[model samples]
Target: MSDWGVDRGVRVLKGVRHFRHRIRRKMDIMFDAYLNSEGDFPMCDSPVWIFGRSYSVNYDLDELRRSVASCMWVTYRKNFGSVGETSLTSDKGWGCMIRTGQMFMAKALILRHLGIDWHWEPDSRDPSYLKIVSLFADLNSAPFSLHQIAQTGSTLGKPVGTWLGPNTVCQAFKKLLSSGATGLDLTMHIAMDSTLVQSEVKRLCLSHPSINPFASATIPSSSIINTPRIDPKWRPLLLIVPLRLGLSDLNEAYVPGIKAVFEIPQSIGIIGGRPNHALYFIGYAENEVLYLDPHTVQPTVHVGSKLDESEKAADETYHSQKPGRMSFLAMDPSIALCFYCKSEADFDSLCRKLTDRFSVIPLPLFEICERRPQDWTTSDPIFMSSPRSNSSGGRNSPGGFTSIGLPGSSSSNSKTRMGSSSSSTFSGDVDDEEFEILG
Candidate 1:
């Protein structure tokens, strides 16, 4: 062979070797995922609680797996369009928190359209399920896509391709839902300063007049009628409560409260994880918290309005068959709890459950008040502004959590009344002060 021929052969050999390496790496990932799906879960003989429903390990193991598999799993994706003006096309490294927020909001949509007991089948073509999944596609058109979340974060002082904390992601979702980008008839209310004001949530939920709070186009009218209508004045509510359970690690005192929230029917899930990494926590088994991890990087899949055969296959990427688990004690101190109330009765039931569960505990996760304290004020420009208002504010620390307290109160009592004082201004920055839970 001539010298040119020899050089061509060498280049061809290198290309073949590169192809083999790529194939091997892909197979290894598949093998790892298969192993994880087959046998990574811990043996929890205790009853498993997932989003208010319990399953028996011995008898309902299959049911438990199915219940978990039904949740929409949003994760890191690559090869999508650039987010905003940045060249970043993938959210692999810095988008975990945003993905967790997507998972949380996706669950709310599922509960709203498919009901609590809705099960997902591999080949099932449920219109509502497909619709819900499409909304989170990586494309820019999807309302809750990574592209939208990242761009929205930019408005809140979070630049594209940067890490976001649980509070910032929750705020992003609130802004997205309020912008009317999502056609779903639901409202998001973020309880700032670790305080959940009943009157505020009531006003937020009831202000919008919905003909049928439980109605969905995919659901038949008969099914809608069967769903009990507690009150016509109420609109569906997505209540996001951002809390700093502890300064660094999750406070052991708040463990029981966190577990109890998962058992409430109104509970959607939680968007939190260990420091830096983010996870979508759905349920708990004994001391372990069950979560859907977003660390896996997958190729971008486009889900359109119509669910064709190819689209159905692509949609499978959005659902995970296996759930990740870790000790609740291992969770980071910064976290956001999500809940969905479809009616007035549901909201009332949530308040009752919260009061019953947290009232007796010495250190409650957060306080529930009928209304904002008489002396309390709402001066957080970022949070208090209209949904579409483009207001700038200080960016929250990527891993640090935010906490609010009564202004000028130097008391360190755990049970002190951290009323909403008008003199106090809310900041995204973290503080050493503790939140007071209103009885």
Candidate 2:
């Protein structure tokens, strides 16, 4: 044989060896994950709360494990298609915040479709549950996939493969939901400036005439046909309140209020973690926060269009049997509190809880008011009517909706809020001057 041909054959053998090595390394990681235990839950007597429902460590430990395991655990995934135009195929290092955001949103979806009481079983093949899982699959078409979130973040000035802050993730999800990416008929309202205006949320939730409440009752999938049913009543709401509890560390005073958040029935969870790390904070037991960590890296798996054994096996990676805990004081102050209100009554109850419970605290994490403060300067409008606006150009536009960026246009008084030692620092971007001073 020619010398050149022999050299080409040698290169081919080396390439095959490299591929085999990669497969073995991936298998070893998977094996380690299977054997690794996430540590037992705290045996302390403090009542365990997982997304509003409370459980006792002594008796309800089994139920607690089920609840924690049922939560959709999104983590770093590899071998998926490149994110946007970037060549990076894995989010092992920079996608924790995005993964946490996906987890938080997935909880909201669970409440929306499967109901808060729905439980996950290993052999269960409920269509609604499967549909939710598919929406977050690593595929590009998945509405809440990492690819989509990273792409949306890029539009919000966040480059792909970069770590996203809590506020940035919330904003990105809000935009994605507004684009009708998730056909769940839910409205996402991000309470900016640490103030959740009751009127604004009601308007956003109740003003949508195009969304059919009946049609959204069931999960949307390829097999179903939407008849354009319209219900101007109350649409399900995903409320996200981005807060900064302290300048550098979480303030001890706000810890009580944070704990109280889990007691509220509408609570989804909080998206925050230690500096440089992100976690999905689902509940709390006394001083420690119970969370689902997204630090583990797993090879991406696709959930097929149908719920079969292969799809079910692939989804097993989306859940964790063990729940991780962290002390409240160890958390980063910059966080986003998530809630899902399925009905008008739920929203009312949430507001009442905020007013009655959170207000009593010395320093409330946030405030709820019936209307925007009169003295505060008016900011940009939250929603704008599309070209299909109704003849009545009033607040309730039956046509459709589109959302702009943050409410305010200028950052003149942003520093004043952060400069004060007692006040919580707030910023829209991670390392930028665009701060929204909470009232």
Clashing pairs in 1: 376-420, 376-421, 377-421
Candidate 2 regions exceeding 4 Å error are: 1-38, 210-232, 305-309, 378-430, 433-439
Report residue 207 deviation for candidate 2 (angstroms): 1.0
- lDDT by residue for model 2 (1-439), tens: 9999999999999999999996785565445333432544778788988788888999998889899889999999999998877898999878998999999988888887777788888777777787788888887778889999888777655678877777667777887788764665788888765677899999888887655433443434642223322233788899998666666556778887988899888999999876667889889887678888899899999766445777777888888877887677667777789999987888998999878887687767876778875555423222432312334432221111112123353332221123244333243322331121210
User: What is the clash count of model 1?
Assistant: 3
lDDT of each: 0.71, 0.72
lDDT of 2 at 49: 83
TM-score of each: 0.78, 0.77
> What's the C-alpha lDDT at position 204 in model 1?
81
lDDT of 1: 0.71
- Cα error, residue 309 of model 1, in Å, equals 4.3
